[model samples]
Target chain A: MGYKSKLSWADVTPKAAYLNRRQIMAGAAGLGLGTIAGPVAAEVPLDREPNTLEQITSYNNYYEFGVQKEDPARYAHRLTTDPWSVVIDGMVDKPGTYDLADLLDGMDIEERIYRFRCVEAWSMVIPWNGFELAQLLTKVGVQPSAKYVAFETALRPDEMPGLRSPVLDWPYVEGLRLDEAMHPLTMIATGIYGESLLGQNGAPLRLVVPWKYGFKSIKSIERITLTDEEPPTSWNKANRREYGFYSNVNPNVDHPRWSQASERVIGAGFFAPRIDTLMFNGYADEVAGLYTGMDLAKFY
Target chain B: MALKDTINGWARKLPTWPVYALGALPPFWYLYLGFTGGLGVEPISELEHRLGLLGLQFLIAGLTITPLRNWTGVNLIRFRRAIGLLAFYYISMHLLAWLVLDIRDPARIWADILKRPYITIGMLGFLTLVPLAATSNKASIRKLGARWRQVHWLVYAAVPLGAVHFVMLRKGWQFEPLIYLGIVLGLLAVRLLRKATRMRPHRA
Candidate 1:
């Protein structure tokens, strides 16, 4: 063999600094930095400060655990995360159940600091550690006929107490257009701030389409089906008027109950003024192309 | 009967002013919670929600006064005014919290009140309570005489509207808000049932 060097990038640069650089680069790339940064430059940079882990783990809207914000934090510890498997089926070349570890094996996990916006007008800056969802789709081989990617959360009534309640019809389902699903920005987060994801924060594996509302980022994914037609999402199915299939964070299109113009930043303290919600949650340059010429107001 | 008599006797001895003083403490406690970070990440929203829910509880409690006397022989009639005023006080504070803490912008506040149906219904409920609160004094009660009872009938409308506001505020069909609405409706239905039964003998 030719003279091989054992030193890796991590060996040369400090691990923390290397990780920080990668995170900054990933965040900048996601924000479409340099091209059209002028609009967002004026507003408070959303993804600069990641929310505290306590705030992230404590406050969640995982209805499978419960409807109350604290319910998931209180009850999600009961979720058995190990021995997890995800079923990848529908329109794909290789369709079968795969072990979580086996599926994620050899995939490069990166730190991505993203602005997580909820349809309910609350937001959080989350530093997620995961690989691009495109990698998984590519490995599985998406068929040309596939138009939508439908995802399903695990339903364990014995473990998940909120399943007992008829809250949004259990096994919280979410979907994205195949193009949107295949976007480089679309991530399958397994950890938050370098730690394994808490059960409340969608342990094992969860989608993180930062541009879309938080609900679209389905948690504890058990099944992922690539379909020709648009798949039904939980909130969209619950109320078509309020939640749309393409729940992109559009400030102009208001949810019937609440204004989308502004969002309350979590961990920003009680008295902090509400920040103006960004178009596509400040990732417009990357994803806004997907919704070009489509009537967002009508769709929303 | 002995237990009911004992309860009513205790109610008679209980001072109404203490209800006002004690009822006023919760909002301050909630403020303390907000300041101390006990209200979680979104403290302003939490504080606003807590105050609104407390106000709704007081409204529901006020509705139960007549029924408690009718069904259980426990007369809380002397405390009705105190309960009603407390409900108004809590609701006003709730509105104030939303105005001051949650949405400080004047134009946006006005826009929400006008544009949003839930806010409109909630505002109407608050307006309904205004006359009831203003006319709660002995002077107005004596001056309005029989009309005071009619003015206070607005509470019947106001309480239901409060429940409806709660129902509409939620994202989807939440059981908690529906349960509140159910209780209010059940209480109103009880009053209607009592009136119908009482009037049947008059018809006979």
Candidate 2:
């Protein structure tokens, strides 16, 4: 009831306003948040299957809902994610804003099984429905000078109560380096839990920068700006010491407050001490080469 | 002899068990809600809000005890341990809610703490209360003696920080958390002023 009016949930159904339940849950591919259903299998290895929005949203991470063991399931319904748009601007050769409809037109989306790790030390393998970020950026014709991509949300202080606070730069700006932008794992998602994304989960469009912590996958994207110099991201500007732009998930790289050496699987319940975290969140082999020369310790 | 015997027996029979049970309600509500499928909805914002508010309520209650005792002759001393422990319990629940219900990525969790100061502070507030609760019992308090007071002093630092954590975690300074902060500050001021005044010895 408290955060209801403020940060209700992602208003994702705008485009899906006319769609059915089955249609709403459809991701880039037809995969939903619960691609396979029933609390993601525990023993499944990282490469076993693709993670879709069904699995991703089915498994959640919106703390604004509340910081509880099952707050997402408890408070997810309060969101109304519809009537959304993306403003494409900044360093791009061919840049033009697009309504949520236009943005969803071109690509054939697919389901990718991604291992999600929070900076807080918990993990879930979600089947996400989205196309690669590179696919869309390519269409928009990002310029060569574009070294980093920054995203922003609409500062709906009247609506998003979270924005009413001085937490992170309001509008929630998040950025990624160009190379990271082009990576195969990066995506822009619209649905989860096998349904159009709930309002709390970043409805219309959200960046899914897997392999890194979840925040890198900025949600409810309203603005896209490419900058030569590093843009001040929401987290970095709010707390410089804690949140650096390159927040890759390395177990060895401890957070200033707690150790990242371990994690607990979402839905696994309490009494489960955090499981040992893997390098690159178990995606190091796939994405580690991206940072070959750069010091992970420093970047982290 | 009759008065002394009867007074001792009545004091022993005073309402302690039920007050303790009343103190356990919030945690029990959370468990009941989860089991009864109260949290079966798609997104979990509502559950989180309730738990967080509940945590704040418990914290406020915990901190309110000393002042309540000072202000009113209400001997809530027996329930103080339960209230203080519940604060920790609710915060842990609030934190777990974020961990399990919200973020499902280990890497993401790391990123949140490192990138988000509010989360870091919130987590610190949670962690500091652990030992305090663990030592709340008579046995641990007796064991730690003066050190128990030192560690428990963290509650003073924690309650406000928890509010700060709540305030900072919000994208904006919504009124509810601010009110929570305001209330906690008021209670803390009373206690601090009391302690300061008591320590001011006969100067003039």
Candidate 3:
């Protein structure tokens, strides 16, 4: 049974408020107003209202900044995002360091409102602004031999205090199967609520895999490598027993330390009930085919 | 020695009822924060964590009293029972926050306590404190005599288990929980070493 959210659409600031903000930012950037019109209406099923911008930006899991939720907001501002570039290599036709703007130049950035479930059994409904990861892979021309896609976050000791902690090995890495990377639902988000992504929220670029746990959506990405071999992910490498490579949101496959059966909704007030967690975070209709016959309990 | 004597004088005059009254304030303050948005977006978890940490701190503080008295000659012995009861109070609140505010479902709570190793360890630690807290009064102390000290010795097991629970709950091998574990182990070691030295003289 799908658990309904206690929150109502009216409780949250309307999506139009952020769209207007985006329009102003887009106007200033010399982007045509026409580009925003087409994708704003594209719907992804959202059971709950999107968290407030303050709630989203203030509470983050970008551990490169620090392990604490608020650490990202406090320390990420020191990161230099203006001159960011992504190095895309390994089995890709166009394997070069591409400037952030040049890479996203012709791509269609759209608003996808998705339920983001963390492995810690808490969740948020985020309104992310970006295009599908498939578009980027298609543009880069993925080789037929490429089986897995590896991603790496920027490692700057001067800017990232959490790097000193040796939490999950410096320069946190993540991976997805080539098919997963090329999935239409997979997005490389650059902004939220029509504003440029806050540095704490992975600022210049981050991955958003809605069906999987939040850690699968690596933040502040610096490298993308398409490889024939299955790539090692930081969390999976750190504790293989607890974190699997797939890390899909299955309520049945519990994290070793906590139950995944239900999740507390962030910004849903103090007394709100923990809603039952869904298989693949309620994206089972769209993404369950990706894991058809595999035993999720074993694979998880 | 003069400074120690002066501190002990102050400690003697210090009424422990104030500690009970004051130590109870933090959980209420955390509840207030949860209501007022001061505990951030995920207040239930934050509240649970803060209460658990405070419980551990009080447990550690209670453990330190005997060592502090033996080493520094500063008597905090009068406040030990009060500190220990406060620890039990905070820990009970921490468990309540998890059960009532966070989980709410009885089946889930039961499943978590059984399945999750960290939660199992935490429940074990909480269980260890129950008998000690129940027997912490003057009546039980007088009735049980030497057995009261034996029952309270359960603190040795409870503190370490609580620290281990903290260590296991964190995402990775974090130093904060490790440091807490280290402190607890060190305190236990100090007690053991003192016992060893005291026995050595008698054996010799």
* Candidate No. with top lDDT: 3
Local accuracy of candidate 2 as per-residue lDDT tens digits, A131-183: 77888888888887889988886655445544434545466788888888888
The candidate with the higher DockQ, 1 or 3, is: 3
Interface C-alpha root-mean-square deviation, candidates in order: 4.4, 8.7, 8.1
Per-residue lDDT of candidate 1, residues B94-186 (tens digit): 999988777777887888899889999999999999999999999998999999999999999999999999999987888899999999999
All DockQ scores:
0.33, 0.14, 0.42
Would you list the clashing residue pairs of candidate 3? none
Query: Model 3 off-target regions past 4 Å?
Result: A1-46
Native RMSD of candidate 1 (Å): 6.7
Order of the predicted models by DockQ, top scorer first:
3, 1, 2
Query: How do the residues A56-134 of candidate 1 rate in per-residue lDDT, one tens digit apiece?
Result: 8889999988889999999999999999999999999999999998899878897777889999899987778898899
B1-204, model 2: which lDDT tens digit per residue? 565456546645676667556756765676666544354322244456677777778888878767765765344556677777777777787787777755545776777777778788887888888888788788998899889888888988888888988776543345667888999899988987998898889553
Tens digits of per-residue lDDT for model 3, A65-134: 8888899999999999989999999999999999998899889897777789999988888878898899
Classified by CAPRI criteria, candidate 3 counts as acceptable
